[model samples]
Target: MTQKYRSRARNLLHLGSTQANENFNQMVSSKAPKARHYGGSSSLMNRVSATVLQKNEGHSYLAKDLESIPDPIKLQNFNDFVTFDLETTGFGYCDITQIAASVGSSKYQSYVYPRCQISVEATKVTGMSHSIATNKLYLHGKEVQGKCIRTALLDFIDFLKEKDQPILVGHNIASFDVPILSRLLKEFGLHREFVRIVPAYIDTLKVARKVFSKEEVNGCYKQCNLVEVYLNIKYDAHVAVEDVNSLQQLFTVKLKDKCTDEDVYSITCKSCKESYTDVIKNKIVSKVICEKLSKDGIALQHLQLANRRDPNGLRVILREHGVPFKKCEDLARKIQEE
Candidate 1:
C-alpha cells in the first residue's frame, strides 16, 4: 500500500481540475438531456448548436435568432406607415408645441414656437411653456430653441417626402391631432403640400379598439395604458418623441398583422375620409393579399379583365406574387362570382 501511494503521488500533484469540463457537460445535458431520445433526431444538432452558442456568446445569442424570424404580416410597403405624435399648448384653438414621427429606424422630431399662450392644464400635462418677454420655448422647465410654426411644418413636409407618400399614424389623430394639424396647415397655407406628401392617416385608437377586446385593454385605450398592457413596460408618456416610439413598438408587435389598408383614411383639403378600394370593400381576400394587390397596382378592373380572359388566370397571377395557394383560390373564386 505504501509503494502504490508513492508511485501515484507525482501524477496526482500535476492533475488538472475538472470544473470546466463538468460545466460544459452540464450545459449539454440541460439542452440535449439523457432522458429524451434526441440522439437520433435532427433537433439534436440544433440543440447542440444552441448550447455551443450560449457557451461562447452568453445568453444574448438568441437576440439575433429572434431578429431573423420574419414578421407574420409581410407588408410590401411597410415603410409607408409613419407613426407620429403632437404636443400642443392646449386643446381648442391651440398651437402645436412639438411634432415627432418614426418609421422603422428613422425618426423625426421638432419643437415649434407657438404664437398663443401655453395654457396651465396643457403645461401640466406636456411640461411645455413659452416666455412672452423672451419669446422662447421651454419643455420640462428647460429653455429650448424652437422653429416657428411655418418652418416646423415645412420641415415635417420634407421629412414625409423622404418616404413614398407616407401614411400618418397617431393615437386619437383623427379627432384630435389631424384636425389640429389640418387647421395649422391651412392657417399657414401649407395644406395642399401637406396632403400631397401624406396621402392618408391611421388612428391607432380606432385600431386598438378593433384589435383588443375591452377586457384585454382593461377598458382603457389610452396610449400609455395600451403600451403597458401590450409591451409589459411603462414609458414616459405625454412627450411627443417617446409617445411615437412606444406607439411604433405597440403597432409592430400587436397591430401589424391585423390591420389592412381598409383601416386607412384618406387626407383631403379639409378633413379625413374613408377611401377603401373596390377589392377591400368587397372583401375579396386577406389583408396581406389585399396589400400585395395594391402594391402591384392590381385593381378590381384588372381582376375582371383577367377573369374574363381565363378563369384560372387570376389565381396564377396571385400565386406568382407569393400569395398562398389557398388565398389565391379564394380570391379567384370571389372575383369570378363578382
Candidate 2:
C-alpha cells in the first residue's frame, strides 16, 4: 500500500493542474446554486445547458440569444416595404439634392434646388451642382429642371401617401438620412403629413449588423459593400434612384425573412428623438469615440447631465472606457458648446 501511494503521488505531480475543471465547476455552481434545489427539476437541464453555453461562448451568448428571439409583432406582408435613399449636399445642416423611393414596380425620384451651394466634394461624388447664374440644376454637366425644396418635399409626401403607412427602409437612415429628413420636414412645416404617411422606418444598416456575423460581412457594412457582397453585382451608386434599387434587391434576397415589425422604429417614438449615435452623426466626436460610448451604455442625455454636473469627471469616465485623451477632450468641449 505504501509503494502504491508513492507511485500515485508521482503520477499526480507529472499530470497537469485542475484549474480548467475548477472553473467549469465554478460556472455550474453559479448557474445551479446549492441554495436552491434544481437537481430534480427540468430546469436543471436548462441550467446545465446555459452553463455550457457560457463556458464555451462567454457572456456574448446572452446578447446573441436576445437578438435571435422573435418579436411578438410581425408584418402582415413583405410587399409593403418601401426602400428609399437620399443624396445630400453635405453632412450637417445640409440640403437634400435628390430623393428616391421604390415599392415593388412603383418608383419616385426628384431633384431639389438647394438654398445653399453644393460642396465641391458632394458635387464630385453625386455629380449634382447648381448654377446660380443660370438658376438651374445640372447633373453630370447636363442641365436638369428641378423643384424648390418646399415643393419637392410636398411632392415626396404625396408619393408616400399612395401607400398605406408604408414601412420605410434605408441604409444608415437612422443615423444619417432620418435626422436630415426630420429636420427638413420640420423646417418645411410638413412633419405631420410625412409622419402620418410613414408610420415606421427601418435602418437596414442596423439590420445587417444584427443579421450577419461580423466575419460574414467582412467587418464592413457600407451600402455599396453590402450590395456587392449580397447581390453579387455592382450598380451605379451615389445616385439616389440607383441606390434605392440596389438596397431593395439586397433586402429582398437577404433580409426579407429575417426582419420583423418590431425591428421597425416608430417615426413618432419619443425615445427615438435623440440617440448617442447622434454625436457621431452630428460630428460632435469621432465615430470611434461614439461607438465606445454606446458600447459602455452611455446616452447623450447622460453625457449632457454629466457634463453639466462634473465636466472633468465625464472626461475621466470616457477615458476609462477606452476613449483617447485628445478625443475625450474634444468631445467634452463639443458637448459643452452644445
Candidate 3:
C-alpha cells in the first residue's frame, strides 16, 4: 500500500469498525430518513479514511496486492477521475438502487434501499429484485451493502470530498445519473452537500455516441448503453462495479491512441457546452410560453377554470399555443432523443 492509503487505513482502524457499523445500522433501519450528521467533519473524515481499507481476506475483485499496484493515475491517460455507475429503480422519478464508484485503487459498492418498490421494467433491466436490494450483503471483496440512499450518498459525498473532487465518468451520467441523484438529494435535504462536492462530469455515453454513432451491430445502429458499446467484451452487465470496470477499460481502449490529452479535453468541453446550451434554449422556450399565456385572455380563462387542479389541461393549452409543455430538463432530454 502507498503511504497515503496506509495512513488512511491506520486512521480508519483508530475509529474502530464495531461502533461505526452499529451506528450505521441503526441509521438505516429507522423509518424516517434523517440528515446524517456524521458527527461533523472529523467523524466524516474517519469514514472516508476507512473507505480505503479492504478486508484482509482474499477476494477475487480486489487488488491481489495493494503494494504491488502501480499508481492509478500514472497508469491511466487521464488520472483525476472516478468512474461511477448507478442502478436505479426505473426511468424517471426513480431512486438509485445501487451505487458503485472507483477512485484510484479504492472501489466502493453498495445496494441502496430506494424506499420505494422497484418496478418490473427496472427489475428486468437491472435484475435488482426488491428482496436483493433490501437485504444486507457484501460485494466481491467483503464490501458491505444494504445502505439506504441517504447513507450511500453521504458516504459517496465524503469519498468525493476526500478525493478533491475528481471528474465523474460514466455512461449517460450527465443526462440521467446526475439529474436523478440531484433530485434524490433534494428530496433527502442533501442537495446542498452534493452540490458542494460536485465535479465536472464526463458522460461516456455522449462520447461513444459521437464517436461511434454510425457503428452498426448486425447492420443496425447500436445504442449508447455501456454493454452495447463493448458488446464483445466479457463482463457482467447491470452490476454497478462490473459496469464501471468495463467502462474504464472501454474508455482506455477506444480513446487512448485516438486523441491527445488536449484533444480529449477540448472535446469534453465542447460536449458540455452543447449540453448546457440546449438547456438554455429550453429555458427560453419555457419563458416564451409563460409570457404568451399571460397575454392570451381566452387561454388564461381556460387555464383558470381547471388551473391548479388540472395540469394536463394547462399542457393542452400550451400545446395549442405551439409551445411544448415540458420542463427545461425534460425538453433537453427530448431534444437529445431526436
Across 1-338, the per-residue lDDT of candidate 1 in tens digits comes to: 78876765543432334675677789999999999999999999989878866764467767732232111223344457899999998989998999999998899999887778999999999999987645678888898868777788899999988997578889998778888998877655577568657756778898899989999987999999999988997988999999999999998898877887556654541221122255566665565665555443344555566778788776777676567888888888888987
Worst 10 residues of 3 by lDDT: 66-75
lDDT value, residue 197 of candidate 3: 58
| Deviation (Å) of 189 in candidate 1 | 1.7
- Report model 3's TM-score to 2 decimal places: 0.49
Which candidate, 1 or 3, has the higher TM-score?
1
Ranking by lDDT: 1, 2, 3
- Segments in model 3 whose C-alpha atoms lie over 4 Å from true places: 1-79, 131-144, 216-232, 256-338
Provide backbone clash counts, one per model: 0, 0, 0
The TM-scores of all predictions, comma-separated, are 0.58, 0.58, 0.49
> Which scores higher on lDDT, 2 or 3?
2
> Candidate 3, overall lDDT?
0.54
lDDT score at residue 149, model 1, on the 0-100 scale: 78
lDDT of 1 at 253: 90
